[model samples]
Target: MTTVLERSPGSEAPPPSSSPLTTDARGRRRKATDVTMRVLVTAAFLVALIPLISLLYEVISRGVRMLSWEFLSTDMQGVFGDMTSGGILHALLGTVQITALATLISAPIGLLAAIYLVEYGKGRLARVLTFFVDVMTGIPSIVAGLFAVALFALLVGPDYRSGLMGAIALSVLMIPVVVRSCEEMLKLVPNELREAAYALGVPKWLTIVKVVLRTSLAGIVTSIVLAIARVIGETAPLLLTVGIVTQVNTNMLDGRVATLPVFAYSQYSQDALGVGADRAWGAAFVLIVLIMLLNLVARFISRRFSIAER
Candidate 1:
């Protein structure tokens, strides 16, 4: 037991011990990499933000000068030439009516189709429907306008141009977007919930109505709002279908009607300087504000429903 062991000459040397300096250098290297990555990500974000900030600044600065109570309350019925005493009431009314009609037409159809696709669809029929929807989604806004125009001309008369026609055109553009978004939202619902409902003797339709739709209500609303936003700014469809009018026309089926986009286009085209240009900028500003309000409303609804679900 008193004898001590010794290393032979042919044996390998013992491994070197790690030093504090080596560990510290490794840690510093890792920290440096993390810092570099963070800086790069932040720089990228700022670069992306530059365009948006610049756009907002330009629009707000140019457009804010023309905004007033008078500009929003009256119509361009009598004001002509270099006269600056006109408003966009008619255009605003037309936009609201046409867009609302479009929503009414598209929302139910889109929601129902999405429900079928998500809850009941199967086999080849579903695939065909999906394919058609994909095709419709890519259809140009101008083509939708022309299609509506042709359909109306064939059904009614070749001289027809009305807010209803514009609504029809917008609905064409909006439905596919609604369907896609609603389908994705409905798919996000858990299967376990559906199964639980079924186990309780709930019918498939009732389960979809009560459990599935209620659960995804917020998302559905959001999708609808997004669809509305997508079509609301379109100029070609409204220009072709709704036409231009100076006075307010509440009846969507009657005569010509002006919309915000068309109004802006007409004004800008009439005169790039002076009163017409001012009116154009004002209309653009108003449209932007309207969209912002819609987005805010959607967010509020989403938050409320999310809280209710919790």
Candidate 2:
């Protein structure tokens, strides 16, 4: 018996190859989409950086000449007018001291508050605290300074102003930031870690401190650094609370302080040209450098902690 191999009309011959144009069209579409996306993202990034680059260029160009050792070491205590005799010594010192004090005062309190909100929060109390924290976060820096002034004046006299006062105001601003950042970081810690700790018979507090905080320590540090950064450049609060002086006062409790922000303000506002202008630019450069250094430090710490975790 002979078997016949019959095929349908189109199937009688080998199937036709896919059209090259259709395949090419799809490939072209995908390529175009990818290129378009890349171009858009790169353009957006460059646009965002333009202002930053311009500002940096201006500051460095104007400020580089004033970065001499003598300019950095001397204070404008007795210098007057267009005389360029003093450096930012007093202002730099006060900035460091006040910011350091503010960080010390804010960090631990914020960390604890964050822990409470993340680990133990449940119900109405947490909600109330959260609402208050959100409110505090939005409070203006000037308001914080004013509040600090009013509190200190009420306690001491209406004539109270000191580096400590400035620090207190900065702390008030920093605490809410730290709290919010730390709370978010803590929430990122895995539930499994907590469960494992519980399985191992670890106490609740120990689990939180060891398993949770250690897991998110890098983020916490970064957030605290952010809080520091937030307040470091605030001119209004420091100006109001610290009340700048030409002379450096190491005793934060007793005398007015000269922070970089306030120093820059005083220089620029008092002298828009000549030596004062130069000094203002110089102060601004130093401030930018300080902030950059802090960011570098935070990056280093974050990397170190992350590596240790891994």
What is the alpha-carbon lDDT of model 2 when measured against the actual structure?
Answer: 0.92
Sequence-dependent TM-score of model 1? 0.89
List, residue by residue over 1-310, the lDDT tens digit for candidate 1: 6998898989998898766544788777887898999999999999999999998887788889988899899999998999989999999988999999999999999999999999999999999999999999999999999999999999999998888999999999999999999999999999999999999999999999999998999999999999999999899988899888899999888899999999999999999888898899889989999999999999999989963657
Residue 276, candidate 1: how far off, in angstroms?
1.1
In model 1, where do residues sit more than 4 Å from their true spots? 1-37, 307-309
Candidates in order, TM-scores: namely 0.89, 0.90
lDDT of 2 by residue, 1-310 (tens): 9999788777656689876644788877887898999999999999999999999999999989899999889888899977869989999999999999999999999999999999999899999999999999999999999989999999998787788999999999999999999999999998999999999999999999888998998999999999999999999989888888988799989888899988888888888877888899999999999999999999998988873657
Which numbered prediction scores highest in lDDT against the true structure? 1
Best by TM-score: 2
Judge candidate 2 at residue 146 and give its lDDT: 93
